[model samples]
Target: MIDHLRDMGLGVDPVCRVLDLSPSTYFARKTRPKSARRLRDEELIPLVTAMWEDSGRTYGARRITRALVRSGRQVARCTVERLMRELGIEGVIRGQRRRTTIPEPAAPRPPGLVNRRFSAERPNQLWLADLTYIRTWTGRVYVAFVLDAYSRRIVG
Candidate 1:
């Protein structure tokens, strides 16, 4: 990475200083042989990458690990998870649903005492709730109102 930055017209000494890496240590480490685990990871990276792309980037660590295991490759889910994090690839999930009128069958039922009659002779007898959206330069803002049935004015 430091070499790449240097190639991009950045000075190596400043880059190394910013990364808190000593120049001698960096070069020495680069010359050292990779560990067995690192060698295995290097071999698996390409396979994991291909599989992730094949799945349209929808495969998370667990799914990727399963695919590798099914192909007779021995690897742990956690290692795959770490690799995915390092590579900055992730599976997308559906966000919270926006439906407001969904019914729940298992929820306790309330009696229909009003029968949809919104009229009221007294101020506090009935109330109506409504939601409206106001558009502004930035975005739409939702406003909710509680109206008194008798006076047709906002109650609460």
Candidate 2:
């Protein structure tokens, strides 16, 4: 439409005015081209994209920048972040985890024979036994271990 208007001897400003477009908008479209800086950014985008993928998408901007620097490519963190944003890439966010230990009131409790002081004067003088659970496809499996505190050996 702009080309047709221009060929008909109507200047871009007058055509844009007739079409209800601002002068700045018309001139912006006319002057916009593949600038050297824009071309460089476009070229660097693929490099950044490959690096982001090669890291299994786990690295944030800082790590990606470091990886680029390690590979003899000096890149800034903000640059990596901007390229990642322009490429529609994002970093993974890990979720916070909680401890799984739970106290069992119904299970039998063994007496604290050592009185919480684990030191034993001689080998075989004191032994400790504990049972724990392990998860498997079949369900939870119980494991019992007997230990000699003095020798630090698994007696059973």
Candidate 3:
């Protein structure tokens, strides 16, 4: 920026004053060498992107860093994270959610039992029910379970 401004015949002092910069700071920056770390990061960005694509765009920063290191590159996870942010590329974050057992719109909900309190003083005093699904070689299976609160065992 200072170089461009000075190229237009704007003297250092005038440019500094206009941009609210100190002359000493400007001269220091002008004389300072580029950081080796920054240069390395610039070079690492392309390599990182390639690895990300190689992993089908599903490798997050930690995995990318691991792949880079395994390929004989020394890079920090945080550095890869920052570069990924700059490139606007990211890995897909996957999590499991129940997809089956959609409730009917007119289905009635039972009144609260134990008032949402799971613990019970007796084995049959409270029961908890939950529905979930499992995947097998044949197909998907839906399951419903009833548990005794006090005994913490399957009641049904």
- Predicted candidate 1 versus true structure: per-residue lDDT over 1-156, tens digit per residue: 987998999987788899998888878887999999899889988988998999999988889999999999989999898888878898766455345457889999988777889899888889888897776667668889999999999976
CA lDDT of each prediction against the hidden true structure = 0.86, 0.83, 0.90
Q: Compute the lDDT for candidate 1.
A: 0.86
**CA displacement after TM-score superposition, residue 113 of candidate 3 (Å):** 23
Q: Please say which candidate is ahead in TM-score: 1 or 2.
A: 1
Superposed model 3: Cα runs more than 4 Å off: 95-156
What TM-score fits each model? 0.49, 0.44, 0.52
How many Å off is the CA of 43 in candidate 2?
A: 1.9
lDDT of 3 by residue, 1-156 (tens): 888888998889998999899999999998898899878878998999999999999999999999999999988999999999989999988766556657888999988867878898987888889888788767778888999999999989
> Model 1, stretches more than 4 Å misplaced?
1-23, 94-156
TM-score, cand. 2 vs. native? 0.44
Candidate with better lDDT, 1 vs 3: 3
